[model samples]
Target: MLLIAVAMTAILLLAAGVVAYVAFPHRGQRMPVVPWLGHAMGKAVNAMPTGTAPQDFYEPQETSAR
Candidate 1:
């Protein structure tokens, strides 16, 4: 009984390790948000510092007297 129990425990541990390894390929990659949304957001955000946007993107507010 003791040997059988030990063998079962070792088998379980090996199975758990194999499952962890095989499932690891899908572990950490960030899933893109809404298909091409990731690429679009990255381009727009990255362009801000490089000043690649059109001039009409910003507008001035009119001053008013109280």
Candidate 2:
């Protein structure tokens, strides 16, 4: 019984880790405001600061209000 309980606990922890990795790909550095919304948010948030795409698309003044 104890063995089965430990195995189940380990399985649950592993599952949680996998889910976390999938949800936040960048070592959990960024967290989305909405659950499972990382895919949408990451496009802008995950871009490199030195990259052209983010600079071209990001609005500096609009975001400053927040």
Candidate 3:
């Protein structure tokens, strides 16, 4: 049935993604097993805004000199 075929395809794609995640080097390090996917992921990350640092939430304390 068409539903079975779709399920099988989904399973195969999921397996491929898992294998690529494990086998490939992280993005911006070395070449990945799947270049296009790595490039897409890198672009997506770069497009996002930078995260706030922990220091941003607190004021700096002044030290008293002896």
Clashes in each model (backbone N, CA, C under 3 Å)?
Answer: 0, 0, 0
Question: Which residue segments of model 1 deviate by more than 4 Å?
Answer: 25-66
**lDDT assessment of candidate 1:** 0.57
In model 3, state the lDDT of residue 45: 60
Q: Which ten residues in a row have the lowest lDDT in candidate 2?
A: 26-35
**Structural similarity to truth (TM-score) of each candidate:** 0.37, 0.41, 0.46
Residue 30 local lDDT, model 1: 32
Model 2 per-residue lDDT tens digits across residues 1-66: 999999999999989756765767545555555545555545655574754566656565555564
- Judged by whole-model lDDT over C-alpha atoms, candidate 3 comes out at 0.68
Q: On residues 28-48, what C-alpha lDDT tens digit does candidate 3 reach at each position?
A: 453445577766656666787
Indicate which candidate wins on TM-score: 3
Tens-place lDDT digits, model 1, residues 30-55: 33434354444445545766546878
- Global fold similarity of model 2 (TM-score): 0.41
